[model samples]
Target: MNYLELDTPALLIDREIMEKNCKDMQDYADREDVALRPHTKTHKMSKLALFQENMGAKGITVAKVGEGEVMASKGLKDIFIANEIVGEIKLRRVRELAKDIDISFGLDSILQAKMVEVAFEGAEKKARVLIEIEVGEERSGVVTEERFTELLDFLKQCSNIELLGVFSHDGHSYGAKDQEECRIINLEAQRRTLQFAELARKKGFLISRISIGSTPSMIFNFPILKGITEIRPGTYIFMDASQANAYGNFTRNAATILSTVISIPTEQRVIIDVGAKGLTTQRRTKGFTATKGLGRIKDWSGVALENVFDEHGILNHQKFHDAVQVGDKIEIIPNHICPVVNLHETAYLISDGKVIEKIPVDCRGKLK
Candidate 1:
């Protein structure tokens, strides 16, 4: 069936473009001699995760235990929960998963390490752990040398958990002023992660894997830094308007929100069917990216989504107001693909303007 025949406010994935994006990243990882463990949080589809695995990805990276469970249930054996898994409930869940699959999660505190140790007490397999280091992102992970050594001391005595390696994410690269700043941030992030790995080894922990990544940093600094074993980038799968703004264009954007121009409220504004509920309300600021508005209109470079309510998006620009009318359809590249994907239940796969298949977002709303 044709894509236009479908209802408005739909999520569409260009199959060709998405596959190309996957292959390109995988090839880059191969050339760099780093393991490609693409994060599944971007698509949240089991089949798409499998598609990445088939394209030479070492394993899959997920943010939550529920997402790891969802992927494991679909026969994904090697999984890494990049975010710190805290609390008894979540620790028990990860421990249970380790019984059948090769599983690992992030840790930054001695308390988390102790909890993991207690959770895996007397388990058949030891819990493989990665110590997360702070490399300018400042969101999570350990930054101070004292705190890292404290966590290392706690892990040294634990018999149930094995310190696998260290990992870091240069999330701040998204806020870089330009490509040069991105390069500096990526190198600094990698250097810090590698330095911490050496610190762990000096403290008697036999470190092996050293991972660090973010889409912007990965794109700008691949094969330049050494000693990093893996790269976990989620957004590269479905390039968004924000990524296009930082990188170049939407030619690599695989996903788009299909919406209709519902009303021409004024000569300067037009309303779209999708708003916060469908396309999300994430915006790009001065340092994040060069995106000028809420979202980018595909092919209509002169127009953009200036504002959005629960169910209505206000399209701005004179060309947009003049060219678009009520009932006209437009495809939008979202500012952030992650949250936009979470808002949809299913994504329609398209090729040559026709629907090829429909994939369910099986991991959607798996917050726990």
Candidate 2:
């Protein structure tokens, strides 16, 4: 019944902390009039996705079709794939899901739209679509208004596709100089989505949703400006070391990797059981909150453990290393929680140090 008894290298979630985090974000979104559609890519658990929906989330945001398939099987009514969905097989799968749920995904160009149009030709329903605007994050999406307009026209002519709305991820905010930069990124993202939505409306295209979000930036999106309809932030549900460093320590980030001290190589060096396989080396952070190591030691705050091995983590903390031993258990607040979650099959939901429930990482490895 206790999470400690479960096993080593286990994914642990503090239920109370997770609940508080969700509710707090929901409340913030409600106050701002922005629909909270938390991203399910971080947890990769449909149960957690449903949990977000139950906590005032309008829907869940997924990054891949494989993830959408897993969630749809669990009866999730609405989902938006925030990333571009390509490939014929993947598109056909998307069409198949359109028959069951309110499915939509990101589009950057008409060529991608053409691929979808062909895939949905024989489908029983049309695909819901959203044009992802590149507000600041240089990942994907139409970066200019002209390009945005071009993509809209392309999708509008499609018989099998319906233009639902426009969305943007203010991911660039994470690298800002201060909270002001975060606000500017989100504000500009909202402005871009709204601008495109207005243009589409004027052009006689039906634009119903105007979405904008980022976990670090959404914390400042409370004053809901006009035209912003939805907020899809995934990290708010489970805070990580990077997020904690970005948003401050008050955030309710409840998930962490519970590892064991495998060896005390020396007084200044220690090895943890968790390695690249369990915790990834994704240091996709920005600004002063950027992390130099693979992850931070949760039990020992402020210790960013570096020198990650394939099967071991080399921590360079003299006092911290001296305090740990070969068999002592330690919790890691990973640099990036998303990948760490994908490596685990399940998370031990803990309350008061006891395992209350075991939830599968249902959407884990849904990279297709």
Please report the candidate that would top lDDT against the real structure.
Answer: 1
For all predicted structures, in order, the TM-scores are 0.98, 0.96
Clashing pairs in 2: 239-253
lDDT of 2 by residue, 185-290 (tens): 7777788778878988987888888988888877654466877888888887787877777767734669888888888867688888889999988885568357
Model 1, span 160-183: residue lDDT tens: 999999999999998999888888
TM value for model 1: 0.98
| Error at 274, model 2, angstroms | 0.5
User: Which stretch of 10 consecutive residues in model 2 shows the poorest summed lDDT?
Assistant: 218-227
Clashes, model 2: 1
lDDT of each: 0.89, 0.84
**Candidate 2, position 245, lDDT:** 75
| Candidate 1 lDDT score relative to the true structure | 0.89
For every model shown, the clashing-pair count is: 0, 1
lDDT of 1 at 287: 69
